[model samples]
Target: MAGNDQAACADGPDFGPLAIEARGLVKRFDGVTAVDGVDLTVPRGAVYGILGPNGAGKTTTLRMLLGIIDPDRGYRRILGADRPHDVAHAIGYLPEERGLYPAMKAVDAIAFVGALRGLPLKEGRRRGRELLEQHGLGYAADRQIRQLSKGMAQQVQILGTLVHKPRLVIFDEPFSGLDALNQGKLERMMHGLAQDGTTVIFSTHVIAHAERLCDEVAIIAGGKVPFAGPVDVARDRIPAQVRLETRAQDGPWRAALPADARHEGSFWFFSLPDTGIEPLLRALIEGEAGILSLSIERAGLHDAFVAIAGEAAARALEQEKPEELRR
Candidate 1:
């Protein structure tokens, strides 16, 4: 409801303060650059998302950020601390792969991890109870971890991440096994956390999930970032597509559009042009076909992702050695 005080998480880099600056991050594996030079900054109480296709180096980046691995070259300042993982006591991290102990009771497993993150066993269990109740999983706390469904397990992992009251939360593929409703629940929880001033960073393969949940996003492909900005601003990277929905039998704008643009039923499609489709639409109005609706369709985050991915692919192809392409 309140968007202005969006700095809810980084009130001063103390309680889950701003922890989103990574500079010139470079990671290499076996003489191959997994993450090329890249710089990113996220504020406190901000929902920052990292997105890319499989094998696009997203996991490597997250691993480095979590301190499970370190960058060969780079620097990061998180939560006012130079080392993010060392401050695990205040940072909650949920890896993409589920790591819950199958035989342990869900509640006990959660508390155990909280304890590892620095909570006393008693307080860990107590806080675990509160988190379960808060996230609507109180009834299932006593069940064995393996007995829980995939969605339930995911919720448990998320609960565990936050059990220790970490200020900065990192989630990799948080929506992995969720149906729409469950995903929505997780999204709501994420929003609630940000509202309470927790700097939340997540990595996802799906553009839509990141688009909906993040205040800002970084789209990385082929170890390069082609787009890193606000969601609405990213949409403008691709020229806005012009859509026309009408019953007119003879739409004059059809031939002017790119060959890839299609006409289906009452809808005529056209990609954003250099000068935009404005002059063309004005021409249509002058011709008098009785316009129904003529507006620029907002490009989705997926569209922007695809646009950058295509560019990366092209660049990679150009940079690929002749021997590599032959193989």
Candidate 2:
């Protein structure tokens, strides 16, 4: 049973080596080429993120890796195992599109999913209840899932995915339909799982969470990966920039830096090709411009994402131009 092997990750890193690896991964649906030659690598026990705009093939890529859909080309490995289907016992997935047994009680819903994964019936029920209560949905154990709020229902789905205690977890837009409160809860849950040695890979269009939650990130667009690196390393590579909010007077910072600095209201922001910012900062202290605040601004995943996904999102938008024009 899949559940019998579900806790297999507890003994060691799945199959060891790379937790997830894909080279020249390609997939097509209806001949549109949803995923094209994408490559990815994820370390064991790390929180990895994939950022992309809609239709950038993030979902399709995940589907292929999870063995739900077959990629037309390329190769992938999970926990050193080439067969994703065979490794299903160690993986849990939450898709952007949700499916639940609405008529079933919340506890029963989660248990049902665990049962399919080969979880023992008694343990499945126990885990279902524990996860529900831990997520603050305990009181709704006997309540029908359809009667819960959208956010509560979303939680039920998330619980279902992890009920069997899989070693690798994948979330597709896990934060899409929730308020700030619930999003925070999910974030905490993810962190907790990672601390327990679960390897996690999730995709999102939002950059802030990826910046905070992931050790490394990959930005994909046009069915390809344009950037993949450690968050700090990626920030350092994109050019060092600075933001200063000071009095609008003739400050030395304005005079000492390169001439290309931009003024946004009273704030001056500029990027330096070189990292030697000491000279400029020293000049600012000497001038006494009453510097309200100074902050180093590095290029973030959002910037790289925009630089990469911009073209793809635009193409998707353009494809809908005719329908939009009709409106």
Error of 2 at 96 (Å): 1.8
Per-residue lDDT over 92-191 for candidate 2, one digit per residue giving the tens place of the 0 to 100 score? 8999998887899988888888777777767877878877766667899889988999989898888888888888999999987877788888887777
* lDDT comparing candidate 2 with the true structure: 0.78
The lDDT for every candidate, in the order shown, is 0.75, 0.78
Tens-place lDDT per residue, model 1, 280-327, is 767667665567887887888767766767865434433432332334
Which pairs clash in the backbone of model 1?
A: 8-197, 9-197, 16-167
Where does model 2 exceed 4 Å of error? 1-14, 243-256, 262-268, 273-275, 281-294, 311-327
